[model samples]
Structures are given as C-alpha cells and as structure tokens.
Target: MQEATADTFIVRIGAVSAGTIAEDGEYPGLWGAWDQDGQFMGRHASREGVAAFLASCFIVDEQDWS
Candidate 1:
C-alpha cells in the first residue's frame, strides 16, 4: 500500500459567481482559500464538486460593485 503523506498542489480560481470561482488552467478545477503563504488552502475538485468546499472556506462573499 502507498503511504499517505502531505502533498502540495496548485489550482487556479477564475471569475467568481455565486461565491465560487470557476476552474481554469492545467487542472481546470475549483479551489478554495489561500494560506498566509498564498498557497491554496482548501479542498479542490471539479467545479461541480467544489461548491460546498468553497462555502466551507468562506470564499463566497457579496459581489464587489466597485
């Protein structure tokens, strides 16, 4: 069996709609917040699989009107 270990990855978050950013780039998948170091700090998966994930990370917010 493969040993479980910590791994790092990158995912691009595109334009936000309804508090979620659509997926883009090589992985083309949704991602949540970022850590202090700017590393993505949440679960990532297909757009359809990340809605709840985004909500958990509180990335969803009122639309910016500015």
Candidate 2:
C-alpha cells in the first residue's frame, strides 16, 4: 500500500501496480476505484475493500492468460 499522490491510494502486487483508490468526489464518503489500466471499477466504502477488489481482479486476469 502506498499513496499515489496526496489524495490517491495505490495498491501493488509484488512490483506491479494493481489499482488505485481515491476519494469519490461524486459519491462523497465512498472511494473511487480504478484498475491498473485506468478503467473504472466501482466505488468502495473503504480502501481495504478496493484493495480486495483489485487483487481479485488481478487473480482472475492472470488465470485468463494461462
């Protein structure tokens, strides 16, 4: 876990960037989520939720490449 900027939280799996979580300006209190490719995932109530979502997405994507 690292701060992408002052406002954004970055989650990495090993050395790869998994996704990012930031305050959802439109939803207030919720966190906006985006995949590594910058695709919108959804909004989460907490950073932990966002991280779990990104990790699960990465796992599924990795399996698709196999």
Q: Which candidate should be chosen as best, given TM-score against the real structure? A: 2
Candidate 1: tens digits of C-alpha lDDT, residues 1-66: 111123222223343322423343445454443432444545466543454554444443434548
**What count of clashes does model 2 give?**
0
Global local distance difference test of model 1: 0.40
- In candidate 2, what are the lDDT values of residues 18-47, reduced to their tens digit? 888898999989888788899998878987
Model 2 is weakest, by summed lDDT over 10 consecutive residues, at 57-66
Top lDDT prediction, candidate number: 2
- Give the TM-score of each candidate: 0.31, 0.86
Regions of candidate 2 where Cα sits further than 4 Å from its true position:
64-66
